[model samples]
Target: MNRLYHVALSPFCRKVRLTLAEKKIEVELVEERYWDPSPDFLRRNPAGKVPVLRMDSRLMAESQAICEYLDETLPNPALIPADPEARYEVRRLCFWFDDKFNAEVTRPIMNERVWKKIRKEGYPDSRAVKSGLAAVKFHLDYMGWLLDQRRWLAGDVMTLADFAAAAHLSCLDYISDVDWNRSANVRDWYAKIKSRPAFRSLLADQLPGLPPSPQYALLDF
Candidate 1:
């Protein structure tokens, strides 16, 4: 059987998981402590990233590459658009969330609020959390603007871009960091995506000492 080495709350891992689930690929989820990487884990991915997928006798390292490969191999429910321009937009938005949003918001907030507690590294940093909270509002407004004009972030059809964005927001929402009421458009968009069958596993995830927020698993929320 195919297997995935990942951390439950990592947005990058979640993106790959979402893509796999969307395409109906069954993978054994193995929670790896990448911070304390073993030789076997490092051999799987020299980069020592959390999302290392072992599939079809191949070890896939990067999240985007793995997800896109799955989309290309399983074309039934295509996640990336066929048109070059549309494809570029999807990749651009995917990077927007994975890199920009992750750097400005997800990393900061999660590092302080979730990772610290999980790793037992240190206490939560209020300033960093506050900064991330402030930054997320801007991102929510940006998403709202995008959704205002288009059916999805990249286009009319749901694509990997939506999964990328949702991956980050869902992590934050797990800890009650996202203020869904900030943007009606974004809120509605999330509601639609969150209700998908692929989202069930993520909604069910519980970080031992740090349980998800009350509304984290609520479909109506």
Candidate 2:
């Protein structure tokens, strides 16, 4: 059986999970405490990331690479575009969310509010959380602006770009950090994505001692 070692709220793990679900791949989920990596886990992925996918005698590291490989092997529901230009746009947006937005918002917020508590490292830093919150508004506005111009983040079709963006936003949404009211377009986009059949598992995820927000599982939300 295929298996995924992941943290419930990590956007990188969620991105791979979404891609796997969308491709109708059955995977046993294992919650990995990445900070306290075991020797076996290290053998699976020397980089020690949460989203280590073990499938068909192959162990895959890197979320983007795993998602792309899945998309390539299961072409029925293509997540990456076939056209080079379109593919470039998808890759660009994927990086925008995973790199820039993660650096500016998701990583900082999750580090302060979630990881610190989980690791028992220290108290949540108010300044870091505040900065993340402030930065997220700009990212949301950018998403809203893109949605105003196109049906999806990369283009008219739903692609990995959408999944990448959704993965990050869903984590924030789980913590009730996203200001959905700030952008109607962005809110609507999220609502549509959140209602997908593939997203059900994500919505159902229950972290120990950290329940999702009320709106996290609400389709109308």
TM-scores for all candidates: the values are: 0.99, 0.98
For model 2, residues 1-221, the per-residue Cα lDDT tens digits are: 99999999999999999999988999999999889889998999998887999999899999999988889889879999899999999999999999999999999999998899889899998999999999999999999999999998999999999999999999999999999999999998998889899999999998888899999899998
* lDDT per residue as tens, model 1, 90-122: 999999999999999999999998888878898
lDDT of 2 at 201: 95
What is candidate 2's CA lDDT for residue 216? 89
Q: Residue 56: error of model 1 in Å?
A: 1.4
lDDT (CA) per prediction: 0.94, 0.93
**Model 1 misplaced regions, further than 4 Å:** none
Model 2 whole-model lDDT (C-alpha atoms): 0.93
